[model samples]
Target: MRGTVAHLVPVADPDEVATIIAASKRAVGAAVESLHFPLVPGVAAAIAETDNAWRALEAEHGLLDAAAVSRMLGSRGRPGALANDRRSAGKLIGVRRRHQYLYPGFQFDAARGRTRPAIPALIAAADDAGLPHDELALWLCEPSGQLGGDRPVDRLDDADAVVTALSAHVGVQW
Candidate 1:
């Protein structure tokens, strides 16, 4: 449920940005519904439940190293601020590859920059949760081919498809 909230304006076309935004909203909404809960949960219980589930999966799979998660989150600088921001951390995968990355709400060192593929982080996280890794990886990376310096409307559609597929694969409500 925790996500970044900054508005992402694609460098392509305004119309494309609008389309991407709409598709993103629909995709996220669908994902939330598939999960049987809202993307941004209103109650603490929901958050705790999700967190506990993730933690339990992590303990079970050992796919993601705690050091990696800690390092990634810590490297971002203002972890609290980033969490409050509604943007998907996974989105950074594309932004990092396409533009001068700026997590507006977080206090990270813009200079250090990103070193690994953002999609990998999501895969690792999912893996640690005992989730299907191969399927999720395909879903997450499917959009990369459509994304570039151009308008991301097409990529956004691909992303939506990926998220929708992932939601279904994970038995989440979308």
Candidate 2:
């Protein structure tokens, strides 16, 4: 096994985020082009739908909880080399939940296992989409919580922007 582990940090500037996203998009476009998937008529439409869905989630709920993000990115594994291959390709793992005030009257229910990390999912999504893996990985790991030097919402907004930019980069439709 490669046994390589790395962390991605969040970005601070919207313009920087956009540039990173654009680069990732170009990468994905090249990968898709190489695949010669025949450019089905609905591919663009599907990508648009996925993009809208991702944007709506960002607009309404902010960066998705780790578990939700993992699910959105289809980070599940089928075991053995397949899983290892995915991981080697920059898939995320080790997601867990952090406490938040959004859910009122909801205590930390320990019965439910810890949430899975979203980094692996983000990585997997990037890999699958043929996006810029290193950039996306960095975005997921870097600590941007203190960047804005303002409210918590600012941090959330930053994260959301990263997610949005990533989705747009991947040309996700729905």
> Which lDDT tens digits does candidate 2 get at residues 73-127?
3556432333334334544321112442111001111235222334444455666
The models' CA-based lDDT, in order, is 0.39, 0.42
Assess every candidate by TM-score.
Answer: 0.22, 0.25
Across 91-124, the per-residue lDDT of candidate 1 in tens digits comes to: 3321221222222211122245433333334444
Off by over 4 Å in 2: 1-25, 66-174
* Model number with the top lDDT: 2
**Candidate 1 Cα outliers beyond 4 Å, as residue runs:** 1-7, 38-174
Total clashing pairs for each candidate: 13, 25
